[model samples]
Target: MKKLFFLSVLLFGIFSFSQTLSSTLNKTTLALGEPAVLKINIENLQGKDVKSAPKNELLPFHLEETKDEIIKKQNNYTREIEFAVFEEGKFQIPALDFKIGENTYKTIPYEIEVINTAKKGDKISDIMNNKEVKLGLKDYWQLYKFYVLGAIALIALFIIIYYFIRYSKREKNTPKVISNKTLKDLELLKKKKYIENGNYRLFYVELLEITRNFISTQYRIPANVLLTDDLIDFMKQNNTISQENEKVVEDIFLRGDLVKFAKTFPDKETMGADFNDIKDFVKRSSKDIEFENIRSDV
Candidate 1:
């Protein structure tokens, strides 16, 4: 009977020593937004691996896992888990369950206190026991009156000086003529060699854009955003473009639509002819515009 009692005690002591878990906090109290470490130490794991800790949402304290490790020493294993918290409260780090072999073990809960430093006017006095300073606008204005007045005077002086300089230079500068801009852009497009490079789609799109932009700028029409058919109808109704130039515009628009949407390829000679037609249309339209302006002036 004595031998039996000794055997049972030995087994109970070994079972108790096989699984051990303890948790501690690096600080019992901390200011809000400051981090404190909660260290969990586990020993004598008995050749069993520890399952991963539960997610942070399950814990009472808002905690995040930092560097944690399970190390083997001789016949026993030790595990150290670190957590950090930033919230302000008196909260408990709940018990953590770890799986070992077929059974589960848990660590003791730890508590921490977090103090908030920010407060409202009355609350600040209550928490910090300090008096508040009250200053009127007149007092503040007296301190920076010269700086404020100087800034306002400088801004007013800058505006007056800028207007004088701008008025003096306005008559010396000539505004950009839209026709000249269109011709320059067209010439640059030709140098890109889109036709010779067999980029028919790009060539047609850019060609259409140049013509539409020219018409839009010179006639105050929204030609750039219009479909080919709608643009032709608009120009016909307005009678803004001469009949001959109108036909040229219609033919170019049709060819561009075919090339862009239908993926039709045109020969280099055909593309060149289209280019020349656009140039002719621009030249005739510009002359007509100049004649109208002269007539209006007279």
Candidate 2:
């Protein structure tokens, strides 16, 4: 009977020692990319409680807080340490040592292995069943002809708008100023009396140069290249002169050339007539002139 009692007490002490320092893992084999839960359970069965688990350095994997559960009857505290290993490999969990009062308890080390997924022929696994997505029938596809037509229309519209703006600006900047001289000035120019002075050639040259200079200053056109015919044609094309004005201009040019190059002397009255034609031309075109205030010498 005494031997039996001793055996019972020894067995109870061994069971209590096993409970004091122990660790366990919840899974035996974990797949790659899956979580494996390792739990280290330590029981403070001694008379005093020390600090919680010792501070650890930067670990290979992540760890979480330790959880505590109390057993009132045993006057014991259990600390549950949880950790996860996310890769596929054999991993060893180090032993955890705890100091209670002057006594120290150490837990046994543990290890685990993670497995990889199986391969199949072009068929996705059951884990990725919901990842296959399909396109709907309502998506839009623009045709090449539609794009080309739109581009050409846009280009044509731009060209038309550009030319319209350019021409409007050209018309606005076009010179409208002709001679702004008074009728009295024209009459005075006619009465210069070149034929009476017997200088018909000088008279024709001065008259032609003055007319060209006036046109040059008024219309901003270079007078050097313009022949009498070209000037008449331009005036007609631009509707600058009436038909009567053009007829008078032609007669003046003919008489001026006869006296200037042909050396045919004109009578004073014929000279006066040509001069009067110039005066009338200036008068008729005066209203068409756009006046600009010329800057004067200070």
**Top-lDDT candidate index:** 1
**All candidates: TM-score:** 0.40, 0.33
- lDDT by residue for model 2 over 1-298, one digit each (tens)? 9999999999988887654655566776767655544444455454456444543321234332233333322435555444455666787666666666666766666676776775656665486446665645433223355677889999999999999999987765444323544344455555776667867787778777776676665555555478877877776775544567657766776677777777678877777778777876766654444222231222
Segments of candidate 2 deviating more than 4 angstroms: 1-192, 288-298
* Window of ten residues with lowest summed lDDT in model 2: 289-298
Q: Compared with the true structure, what per-residue lDDT tens digits does model 1 show for residues 1-298?
A: 9999999999999977676766666787777656666555556766676664543433543655564666655445555555555776787776777676667877777777878766656442355657788889998999899999999999999999999899767634312366667778889989999877878888889999998988887776789899999999998997767789889999989989999986677999999999888987876776656655676699
Clashes of each: 0, 0
